[model samples]
Target: MDKEEYKEERFTERCDDKVESIGGDYDLEEEDDSPVEEVRVTISNTDDPSMPCNTFRMWFLGLIFTAIVSFVNQFFYLRQTQISIGYSVVALVSLPMGHFMARVLPTEDFNLLGWKFSLNPGPFSIKEHILIGTMTAVNTSTAYAVDIVILQKLFYHSEKPFIAGLLLVFTTQVTGFALAGALRKFLIRPAHMIWPSTLVTASLFRSLHAGNNAPGDEGRMTRMKYFLLVTLGSFIYYWFPGFIFPTLGVISWICWIDPENVVLSQLTGSNGLGIGTIALDWSAASYYVQPLVTPWFAQVNILIGFILVAWIMVPWAYYTNLWNSKDYPILSPDLFREGGEAYNLTMILTKNVLDEKKYEAYGSVRMDSFFALTYGVGFAGLTATVVHVILYNGKEMLARWRSARLENEDIHSRLMRVYPEVPDWWYISLFVTSITLSLITCIVWDYMPWWAVLLAMVIAIFFVLPVGIVQAVTNQQPGLNIVTEYVIGYMLPGHAIANVTFKTYGYIVNVQALTFTADLKLGHYMKIPPRIMFMAQIISTLISGVINLSTATWLVETRPKVCTKDGYPFTCRNTNTFYSASVIWGAIGPARVFGNVQGAIYSPVQWGFLVGALLPIPFWLLARHFPNVTWLKYVHWPVLLAATSNMPPALPYFYTNGLFIGFVFAFLLRRYRYNWWARYNYLTSAALDTGVAICGLMIFFCIQSWDGEMPAWWGNPSDKNYDHCPLGAANYYGVIS
Candidate 1:
């Protein structure tokens, strides 16, 4: 397809009057509507080019928040119930701080090397606010590479040099920046790729700056006021779930009815099927799925998948004793032996490589029915993503690829053309540098082979766009970890470090790239300079990588029994899961677990790839044939299959509770209370997240950190199993650890 033809087919001619007026406020009555209704309402079509973005105030505040968020997130990463302090929290906190700095800092200009600038740049502009958000967004979660470091140090008892780990983290974190930069034309500049999650953040920023005094907004609570009030209420209410009456987090009344009945506990416990579970805590409900910001259709798809896998498939598999499921916990992240004992890595390894003789004696590594099945689902999710995207978005993607310089741009893209674009060489240079460093880190440190590093990058490059398309449309990403692990496990069977390193590079690079792309889309919508956005992302990624590794290293070294169950709240749930993956896919290898080897039992699970690839075909055909059946179009196979991806670490209650809330807000409230939903939906989500995060941090520092314990009672049980299901973690065979 030629550029003109592609442009004609994909987009309408550029309307200058709609977006060319600089320094004009967004007048909704006068402007043309965006192709996306969500974007039309949530984001402004107009731009103010005079607004300053790359300011001294932005850098100062952005760096400070980056450090704080990186440390806090990594600190909580080791806890039993992990809570992330998201970018929305940063946006809320930074607003007043930015204004305070603007008020206090001297406006007097400073000259350096013939260039002039000021510490305080007039009033705090929305551009500066967004730049800060861009910076902190990169640090929202702990760097993915840190998981490898933690896996090795805490589980493997072999820590790589600080420099090696640092380079590994930095290269993996920033490599995606290059890919995102290259794909911006397809993912960001286009109008239809709304990146639904960003709209929430954008709406929050606009509300903070635009104020509540807009002419028709009388009697309605301003967004900022509403956010603050909800935040305070959430903060106060979290104390019960966070500490005092912890049972409120997961109220499994069915388990309470008969804790002594193993079958009932397995069916209804917080750690089991979580039947009849009610999570009053926002943190518990929103841990895996962010219900408020996610669209109703996507949430429904996820809920369907969760029900199939968790509620139906898993229970049936356990009761039927599939792959010795009755011998292990009904749902657990822990790897197990033939007799339901924890798989000891030390017994199976000799100098960090699996020993054939020791492995023969130690028996095969196993997992519960839920964990094994989730891997199969993951396989399906990956293939389903590729097929789903090709079916749904192939034409547009092909057109975008053919049209190098798209002429028919959207209002946001057109407004963005005024600012200088980040040069392609900038991304190319960074990409090359990061890849070289990654290869060196892998080969020199013996984390993985040089060819494995290249292969990992290849996998990431291949899957990133398809997976990114899924996340862009629906706020869920199907991960590459399962694919990466399966491939490298067969390739390098006995190397644990190599397997994890390969997975990190393959999975995290794609994830980080999508994250960077999402931020760029946010910048495009808010009309920030592209060059400035690039700078913020790179700097924040680098800083956060360092902080994440440092904090993780510090905790592992200083906190005694940090990863052990006896460590109380410090029990490393995620790190343990990472270690389990390393064992199944690296040290023990998939051949010994899923192949025709001596102990192999679940080879049938490998058929998931075919299952996943074919599942989308029928859905696509049905949607095409029955064009009038609007609901047929919403059957997203990728989202549905990937729904149970967080199963072992995230229990069934999380989905059940999150879906209930999603129905209330995304469906019922969105349809019944359009005005309220439009105004406060995203804000409510942000406020809830912020409140939970703040309350969690305070609980740790003020009470938990100092060994301040709550008095033992019914709600705050001494056993600490808040659901009161004592036998939930036991196997049907009566193996209780």
Candidate 2:
């Protein structure tokens, strides 16, 4: 039997765990492969008068936590909503949602009991929630952290003002959700990717559901305990930095202390490590990344991320000749007419006014060259993905069929443990639902065109799907930013300059990357209905959008000083990050005239891709036996080499991140698990981050107000009288580090 059939058998019989009799309300099947044991989950007891009470408490707690997190994020950034609330809440709340969803849609009905609270069956079970939530949350967080922090803040410094920032986040996320909605059925279901995250989350939910159903054991030991821990842990994590100390976060800057850096440091130009306010704790969390432990393996893990990034950046510098200090001097001189690192360093000078000089960056090319690459990769990935699917996973698909044919026995758990394996039809319906919703949303929001919505769906179907799959397979995303940029370039047709239409669509690409990666991760976890998971993300994101809008509205009207003069909404962590990247990248994209001026020089990806394709050609000649040194590895090696060349400083950030991952891995993977590390470490880390970030943001807001103390103190004279001032200013939120 293939994997699907094997899984079905395991879930049915010859497996041992739940000790309750499911009676006729359940179904079972046995596979010859192993000893059979029944795994039962208790459906909520609808008959009990207290059923509503249980649900009320669970959902009530969930909403409270969400609100609290939103409040904290708002206070720090001066805008609430779109708050992460950490993955734990995402994980915890998902279970309830999953169970509730199953009941509303399930094919069968049954009743079951838990410790103190009995679970009722609508359709599926809590297990689905756990697996789905876990998978999606990880990738979402990963994509959020890596892309937002690095690309946004480090790369593009968005400059639309506070309200604009809110709009940007809202628009982009909605676009992604809409796109995911379009592709959910085609890619999510039937593929049975068994997204790792969804599976595990589902497992956790099953444990809870089953434990509740057991005669002697009730929800008391299970639901109450876990729920309390999650809440207590979440609260403590939020306040830890405030009450106790701070946690630090980091990014790498080889040029900061590099002597070469000082060489480029022109009194009139933006120079030096370009590092100052970012590293130290925001309030208590070190703005600078710091880790408690540096494990042997973490070094390797960080090296991997660094390698990919460096390969794209460093070699291009060498090949393009940007590394030579005496050559171009892009960093020095009164670079920006309006100053500000965003205006000064970026290829395009979008400052107080469109600095004409910045737009003239690329030599013969416009900045967005990646569009062609994306188009090419999309085509290639699409063809290969389909073929691979048919070849590699075809057996399992057939087995699911055979199991269905042989007996109507294989189905959703009696107590709704796993959600009924979602059928493809559901996914298709979700796509249609989203398309219609997006159109409705567009009309209501007046943010996008009707045709634009249709085109986005097409793009999602053809391009984003392929990219999402690749990201799932190898933790790397072939982001379509360049592709979309090019599309915008052509459709919006910026006659010599980037236009508004381009800018509008550009936001969607950013959202697409964020959404795709999150979904991939989510699917990896719970085995939740990709269709449903897709819908949930949309629902949650929409909720986030509303929150962002309301907060931004509040900030704009009441705290207009902070919103405009102070960069209230604009400076919120990830908001600024993406804006920065989009502008910088837009400059470099092939579509922009000067985008490629230094392309061969500074673009690691450009040279890396070329180098990757060509590197192996020569390696084959160098050693006949070195077949392993082929293109993929060859291309990857340079990226790796470039990544680690600037390693040591960035080490702290990656190591700390890994400390959590390691803690999780160690606790989870080690047969005899130390439950405490598994449970509390994540909570502790979350608390540490919340406290630190909150403090820093609040301080930043205060300092920016320059209410009296540091108004003039933040002023600087050398860098074009730009008044860049202390790091917390509208120009230097980077200094919040």
Candidate 3:
């Protein structure tokens, strides 16, 4: 059924309620605040004529699956971070969660699995399992690759061990979860907010529940066709890379293809896209979906981001010859200096010594430094974003609040539900925690100045809103806080060179728009107290911060060869890792004459104002001149769930590990969502994820914590040898002179 019909049908009580007590028959009551309709769902055992079977098998399976998820989530292997653990584990756990949810939920009847299906028109609703399973898969799979890993790691310049570096991500997702929980009713029931991702998941459940008339089946043969599609799709993906279409998407003609190029080389080596844990992260939000049909929005996003970053940003740097090679300046590759530092023009890395020592430098950033900024932004701008969101969206929120309060009266009366409200103390504690932790990090390491520490916080506060939300749109995330960092850099006592420029007003605006895409997703599925989610994220931030540092130190210490190496092998060039880069850029403003306070504010991102001002002129002109083409409709944001890469890939790579997690589960569960197996799917997903997360954390402590790669020198691996220098801090600045 289409969305409206589905809601109409769903709201009307029928065969069974997933959580019947709370979700009373929508058709039965149409009161603005119907007491019965508000009853919350809970699990309860159905009357079983026979004894429950396989207790030992269930326990054993759960334990094994949980262990696998834990290991995978906690460790990094190959190029993949273990975030896939969530979907994979959840796929397995769905079995138990489904059984439990089914048992507890008040259903008119019960349906068992496997052989039991034929006994009595299927006692355990296969439909329920399918729905829940697909949702579980969607929640874990799409969110990570589309939102977190791709955006942060690839587009926004997030840390490799993002766990160690930034707070915004952990904070945002957790907050979204909590807020979504509280805000779900309004978003889902009547307001018409298209929770697109969740809808796909819900469809799966409906299908599974259909006894013979399951959703998505044109007929038994049509359903048979789906099984065939899966077989063919799976076989082609598995074999094509090793045997046939190796670089599936690439131009096989080879004439236009730059076979020698690193990116091209990597793609050439790519195992044709299948159920890969190996992510091709274009941004934290970038995903490797082989959509049979690409939407204009996604196509536009990729095209726009590519044009701006490649055509504008790269060229601007090249023209300036930052590498100092007037004859032949290199713009993109990594170069090592005897002294560990950002690619400075002065540093020579053997550029045809016979002819010239010309070299071009690349910019580097520290994760700690950036986090300091993000933390500051989270502190200051978070308030602004939240306040603005609430205030601007207040009327809607109030109505929702009132509606849920009334509707939930029946559910509360029945069950001892645990809808805990996150308190004021939690937020206050977070503020204090951020302050204390940052100070501890800085003072203990002595890597930056008190002013810089203050500056970092100041940095994060200024950029958080613009950076976060805009990223939600444009399918692009500019690192170095494209707008705020530039403004701050230009305005600072030094750093006004405009060394990095946010390019093209059209695309920059697009990029900036994608920031809140994750929040939008959370706004759909969850019903937890917003305040609680917000607080939980802050708490997660604290945990992530501590872990970030430990991991970063290991990466630096283990390899001891950073910028000097060819590619920034891991998340080495991350903002937090190059905290010192902040100072480097900060000192540039006073160096430039025109970069005074006013001059600083006049930099690029301020173009937001220009665009805001002039955008309407063209818009009105378009409507008048070419009424057929609505230019505004073409604008797209990367932050949408369709685009947002929140958790699918990243979660598996950290904080969780379990044996049962696997890529196929995510794909299979999603494909079968409309089957009878849908209902218990989501519950199973949650269980699997939880199990894997627990195991992943344990694995982190066992292997990752103790056996991590340690840095050899105090500087980037190539230039400075720590063997000669003290184990403490060493300045690569000595080599520059």
Please identify model 1 stretches exceeding 4 Å from their true place. 1-45, 190-196, 403-414, 465-478
Per-residue C-alpha lDDT of model 2 across residues 609-677, encoded as one tens digit per residue: 444444334443444456565543333332233323212122223323443444444434333544444
By lDDT, the best candidate is 1
lDDT of each: 0.84, 0.36, 0.31
CA-only RMSD, every prediction = 6.4, 11.5, 14.7
lDDT of 1 by residue, 380-402 (tens): 88889888878887786566444
Cα deviation of 723, candidate 3, in Å: 37
What are the per-residue Cα lDDT tens digits for candidate 3 across 97-198?
545644554434333552211112223433323322322222232111112232233323333443323432333223323223333333323322332433
Q: How does model 2 score by TM-score? A: 0.54
Cα-based TM-score, every candidate:
0.91, 0.54, 0.44
Candidate 2: clashing residue pairs, number = 116
Report the CA-based lDDT of candidate 3 relative to the real structure.
Answer: 0.31
- Which candidate gets the maximum TM-score versus the true structure? 1
Question: Over 4 Å off in model 3, which ranges?
Answer: 1-28, 31-213, 218-295, 304-420, 447-480, 487-526, 529-616, 624-632, 635-737
lDDT of 2 at 414: 25
